[model samples]
Target: MTSHPAAEAFGATLTPGTRPTVLAVDLMRAYFDPASPLNLPDDGCLHSAARVLEAARAHDVPVVHTRVSYGPGGLDGGVFFRKVPALAQLVGDSPMGELMPEVAPRGDEVVVVKQYASAFFGTTLATTLHARGIDTVVVVGVSTSGCIRATVVDAIQHGFVPLVVEDAVGDRAPEPHWANLHDLRTKYAEVVDEPTAITYLEGTS
Candidate 1:
């Protein structure tokens, strides 16, 4: 059998302590809003992501959710906030900024609110995962060309193996999605479909 490069690189030596955790990032209202310039309605990754979430739950893998929200008046948001001025409205109680119901935060599960593309940048996500004994991350969510890609890169940088679920992530446009996924598959993380990922997680679990 032909070995997948990423599976050869990282999947071969997974240990019992290195439990896989699922991170559903930025599947929020702002991404789906028609008025938002960053909207990616045609990217039907959310439904696939929901399926991943269900599978993760069934397999007992820890689930974490992330949303990009600025603090009051976007005080915590720096230069990046200025570039996307509209993102400032996501702070506090803005309805347009909340995580969509289908992938909403559940009781006791970790929810990370980030201000930048990398979920681990200036966030408690890394610490939380480390404390939970999570060494591998199954990353799913919106805008494959943006935050999802950034998080996958950072996850690898932090010494955690990141597995990108192919159909479980979306982007505003097709070109960037294809380009980023290509780059990720070669460099940052292993890119696999939901079924393969579920099987891998199950085997490792």
Candidate 2:
């Protein structure tokens, strides 16, 4: 673990466990489709996440993916869907809910669907990882200020080291995105670059 003056001051630094798993959260087509409100103009983050996933799979690392969908009329989404009408595109079998082809989950790799921001909320993510003896969660995917932040916070609370790939998560605007990343780096998780994350995954046994 490299020493950071801020981390030293805050007394918050993380040591990633030997058993690391890739948790690619919300890598959906909605963020890539031009007509979709969720579409991000610059999708470099998606490409970065794709590379991270490739490295994790090549190194035999366990992988888990997440997608958000609500029941018809978003009854399952509760207040969140009503708050963000864009969620309508992800209802049921809408093509917008499809996993992005680049980082799509393959056979046998676990995929969890949820209605909320945090992957662990009302989901079996924590239990599932604990069952497999997974101790570190390497996170990559969209909207750094939302789902990614929520997942990392919960991962730390659930006793999993959260290693967020800084280059592999994005938001509609840079302000909230960078602000949340800085906070996560200092308080919740180790926000590292994509290459750093990939190297770590490759080095893990």
Candidate 3:
């Protein structure tokens, strides 16, 4: 991997904490179903996310899944709803809003419902993590340039080490995906592959 000069200068590779919680962000049907407007090209993210989830479960690491939802008229989504009309399909009892079965949350896991791109935005995620003594957040989900990036930025700001599993996240386009990963690696979080993240989870647990 080529190191960025800015990242090298700023010392951006922050150490991960011993305690980690897998923050699976928006791996829902909308992003997985090819027929859906928000769909990506393939189910690669589902497979990767499932592997990370399996590792987390076996290691007894905490897992939290986030789904985007809005109010009836999208009044709760605010300007964000207006900005992105496709998000309207996620509100209410829309089946597209549901999580993909492959990466479904177990009953024991916390499911965070959010309206904005950032999982921490207008949610109790920070407090929930604090209560559980989780110092590191392992983020995995769809759209690297969107929610995944937003969540990583928020996770670090809230005083937690953020590690983004590269393969476990995807975007509709490869350019934005790779670009965001590079940006996140240089700025907000550690960008690792699924195997590396699994090793970390097992070692810590």
Candidate 4:
């Protein structure tokens, strides 16, 4: 791989794991709507995520997806609902809060409805992964500076090695996207591209 200044300076490397679970985080319509305040222009990330999903399926790796949805009247959201008042609008019934069509969750795949950034926060994600014997996580999805970053950090804290697929994650702007990837590469997770991750997963399995 060609070296990037930040990546080189950090000297981070990902140790491939034999058992990997793929986590697709918040690749929903709210992130794609042109008028939405959170929309990221470089949404090609979803395509990369879809490719990773395909590879995961081919390898029979467990797949998990997370979306932020509040209950009716925002009862399930609590303080997080108040912090981002707009979340109240994304009630369980809101179609806009659903995963985007391009990367829709499969029938047997686990869909985690979380109100916070970290997928493991107040959710069954960690327990489910543990139950399934997952030791590594291949992460893909939107808002690299937000949910993706939170997931990476929490994955490490939860004892799972995080492998962040760079091209499969996006942010509202390039600056946050690049900065967060750099930080993740240095301190939290292994920042890699889709093909590298897919090949590693295939080889390990």
* Candidate 3 lDDT, 1-205, residue by residue in tens: 8667763675356899999999999999999887788999867878999999999999999999999888798989999899998998988968998998888999999999999999999999999999989999999998899999999999999999999999899999999999999888888899998889999999987
Model 1, C-alpha of 84: deviation from truth (Å): 1.6
Clashing residue pairs, backbone N/CA/C < 3 A, model 1: none
For candidate 4, give the lDDT of residue 103: 78
Model 2, backbone clash pairs (residues 3+ apart or across chains), number: 0
Per-residue lDDT for 170-200 in model 1, tens only?
8877888889998888777888898988887
Local error of candidate 3 at 88, Å? 1.2
Stretches of candidate 1 off by over 4 Å are 1-18
Per-residue accuracy of model 4 over 35-88 as CA lDDT, tens digit each: 676677977999999999888888888789999888788888888778876666
Native-to-model Cα distance after best TM-score fit, residue 111 in candidate 4, in Å: 0.5
List the lowest-lDDT window of 10 residues for candidate 4. Answer: 7-16
Local distance difference test, per candidate? Answer: 0.83, 0.91, 0.92, 0.87
Which RMSD values do the candidates have, in order? Answer: 4.5, 3.6, 3.2, 4.4
Q: List the residue pairs that clash in candidate 4.
A: none
Cα lDDT of model 3 overall?
0.92
Model 1, residue 182: distance off in Å is 0.3
Better of 1 and 3 by TM-score: 3
User: Among all windows of ten consecutive residues in candidate 1, which has the lowest summed lDDT?
Assistant: 9-18
Candidate with the larger TM-score of 3 and 4: 3
